[model samples]
Target: MNTAHKYMESTQMPSIVAKSLPKTWMTWAVFFFFCASVFGLAMRYFFIGDFPVLEYKNLLHAHSHIALLGWGYLLVTGILVFTFIQNPIRLNIYRKIFLLTVIANLGMMVTFPVQGYGLFSIAFSTFHLLLSYAFTYHFFKDLKNIKSNTGKTLIMLSLVWMVVSTIGLWAIAPIGSILGRLHPLYYLSVQWFLHFQLNGWFVYALLGLLLSFMEKKGYSVQISTPILIALHLSLFLTFALSVAWSNPSNYLLATNAIGVILQAFAYWIILKSAIKYLNHQTNLSKNWINHLLWIGLISLLAKAAIQAALIIPDVANIAFTIRNYVIGFIHLVMLGAITFGLGALALNQNWLVKNLISKIGWITLAFAFVSSEIILLTQGTLLWAKMGFIPQYHLLIFLASALFPLGLIFLLIAQWQASFQKHQLPKFIHKQKNQFKSKNTETMKSTVLMSLGAAMLLMVSCGGGSSENQGSYTPPSAQKEKVADPKGIGEIKNVDLGDGIDEALAQKGKAILDMKCTACYQYDGKRVVGPGFEGVTNRRRAEWIMNMITNVDVMLDEDPVAQKLFEECLTRMPNQNISLDESRQILEYFRKNDFERTGGSDAAMN
Candidate 1:
């Protein structure tokens, strides 16, 4: 009996705990939340007409908060809990706190539509804030004994900032109401809050956590930690100064500019260090890591370019490109760099690594689809703003969209195969494989099948139809005029305008519109949480339009027209700081479109 018991006890332990098991739940949550957010975003863009049960605007706001808070924040927190908290007592506390927070958040999420930002929303939001504070307290308390290291220091800083950011959440409602009164400092304060939370807390904290994981996996490289610290200090200081000083004085601007430059340098150094490390580590077979590293570097470059462009007077003329830089850059950083890294880490977990091919395929598909969507959306906006020509990338878009589901299918299959075929593999592989093999095949099968179904549903809803079917705007063959590039890169030439309007002007208009308008406006004049531009020309004169577009907030505060627009839209349009010439092109596009609609010549419209 003793010998038999000893034999039963003799089992090999896994090299790494199967952290990926928890990640599965988190991934599903993220996937659903993102889908919800995307749908809401599209609805905001495409559906402008009134609805009784819930306004599109409110629905979208709820979606945004839920997606960010519920999915993104919750997933990160869950991962942190799963990884760092090992004690049963600590784990139970975490689970209970998390469950309560989720429930309160879910209550808010569900109530928002019915309440429509009323007392219920206010109450729920307040409760949510309290829950957040509790969460922060508990999480920090748990992490207090963690040994000091660069990664941990970064994470600690991030958490502190997160606490600070949450404080802003409490002020949002009151501050928003005050802003309507044209308080001189209101916009500045709000901007400051946004910058701190987004740039200071969220980004910083996420990166720190990611870095910590990378270090644990023996994937990190030696870099100048002091330089990074200096850069972070500069970032915080500049952000604070920029916010605290309501007026955009020379000193403030210069300091902010320097801070931005330092940040760029920091990013470059980090990228170089990471690349060197990755190059040396030949054992890491994952190809996705390379993609993630490149994306991070590119995002850093994008940030620098955006900062530089903000100083350029004629940037508005190239607004389409600039708009892409701002809006698209966020996704590139968040989805491309951060989420990509997370996915890689999740896959590396013992459970997921066993089913490597499916895991890799699913992740690759997700990355490809998301990246393609961002690129296409940005490019489409730019083309409309600059050249007024939309290229035929529909097939590429469709294929990219399909890849996600296909990958998910493969993942499901791999998971299933892992479950049934575990006993057939070699001892080491079998041990690893058995870690993920479902105790009950039926339950696992149902979950996998459901996930597959969800993926399919997404594909269907997005429309599997080819881009050609939707119609493509091809430029007319015309005479081209060449001019020397103002920046001295090369000669520039005039290109044809597409079928939609005066193609050349339309193209130019598209670029300007993309830079200036895409973030806030869709092609159709529906609001993107802001006013649409369907008949903008008919309503405002050229100078008025230019001024309003360039300096919208100021106009909103003082100008009756802007104020009226704001009241109707219930959201203020932010200034793109566009120049006069670019504004003219946008105006011209509106006029051109008007003429085309009314069967009038361009000369007549002018």
Candidate 2:
């Protein structure tokens, strides 16, 4: 049988049903990437920036939206569009329901950036998700009448997870809100949402889609599918167990250990499976598919390695650095694996293979992936050592950063070129002659308007005024004198507070100042959380500053400066229990600033 006949036989969907899926799926992918880009940029800024500017709380919000709404929801919608088309239900109601879901999802996407967690955003997003769930349920109910094993397995897994993840979402919003009030644990809730959306729904559905696609293509490996499924299932179960078990005691830790081992096993299985399939494939059209599969497999391995390293006692000091590796791994999966896979599917829909622009775009993107992974790994490692090397690594970092945007531009250009080569009107538009043509046009126009509105809201929210109030600065004390010729005008100079002061003592003082004074005082007396410290030495003695930093809790309770500042700022300066050496470093930093203002050399400050 020919490809069309084979597709019809494999899927229960009618011929027309098969035809509609590609357009819907491609549209969903486009929307997903657009949202994902915003999410990726927001996270990069949040993680790499200074504290309190883009606080952890705000970052968590962005992370949750991007991973769950942007990546998971959008990808699932795209894949479902394809799956439903292939399974061609003859029911017009099912078709309209799916179409309405797409429309609702688009509406939610528009509201999300503007309203954020506000009523409209919440309502629209909730509506869209519910619609998706409804559509999935209806689709699967229809599928139960079909008899294909591959189709049954794929649809069943995808639908079950869709329901599961949806339920998890209900748990997420309230839990996140409550924990957000408490903080720190708020981050844990965000993590839970991410894991549920990405691992539970998105990854599972994507795997099913891949398996379905492979089966449709008539390429079957004897051991590859089962091995791949086992690995995927193992990874999912490990993640679920790890997330479900909250404790980190001996028993919980042991369970986590077992989970990590299972993940490792999963990685090995996937890698081996990928190799087997790669060797078996004879079709050149499968090249992109193989590339995406391998990238995903390698990322899983890389993630497992990072996890294992974190668990090892010998190199546990490097655990902080593992976060960067994790981020890199996520990027590889999202951009290299998922994005590439979707792109290939889109290309196949157009039957435009081996375009120059697409090839260049992929190459540039791959370059970006490798360079970014290297830079992130290096920076994370250096950071773990408590050493600064920003200047040294700036070149590679910037180069890696350029890759994604550049590749995106090239891809967009290629897409535009491809569009010009084809007719502007869709096949349905040409065929439908008189049936609701004007209505369809209006619907399309509404979609455009809604999309534009949503885009505007996102721009405003992202670039709008800071969420926190930016009020007038109030000096901590009436005696807070501003020096006209404050120190540290040109460059910073290190100063020795005293000879007997040990490194540990300096660290203690620095820690104290970081905790207590950071919100209100900069070493150079520049205004930040508080007034800058250009002439702090002239205004207050070393002992006075030390006392203030180390005893701010008491000062807030009694001292006039503390009380006045607290009343003015409406925020208390927390005390940092400082040692002698920490107090000395702060004093030394102040002295250094003073010396720099006086045009004194580093030797003079020392």
How do the predictions measure up, each by TM-score? 0.67, 0.64
Compared with the true structure, all predictions reach lDDT values of 0.53, 0.51
Query: What stretches of model 1 exceed 4 Å from their correct place?
Result: 1-28, 31-34, 37-63, 104-127, 181-194, 214-225, 237-253, 268-274, 282-321, 350-361, 364-385, 392-511, 522-527, 536-547, 578-589, 598-606
Error of 1 at 477 (Å): 52
The residue-by-residue lDDT of candidate 1 on 226-264, one tens digit each, is: 776865766665563334233334455566656766766
- Clashes within 3 Å, all models in order: 19, 14
Choose the strongest candidate by TM-score: 1
The TM-score of predicted model 2 comes to 0.64
Residue-wise C-alpha lDDT for candidate 2, range 193-282, written one tens digit per residue? 455555545555655555555656775423346654754455455453333222223443344456566656655654454455556763
Residue 331, candidate 1: Cα error in Å is 0.3
Residue 421 lDDT in model 2?
45
TM value for model 1? 0.67
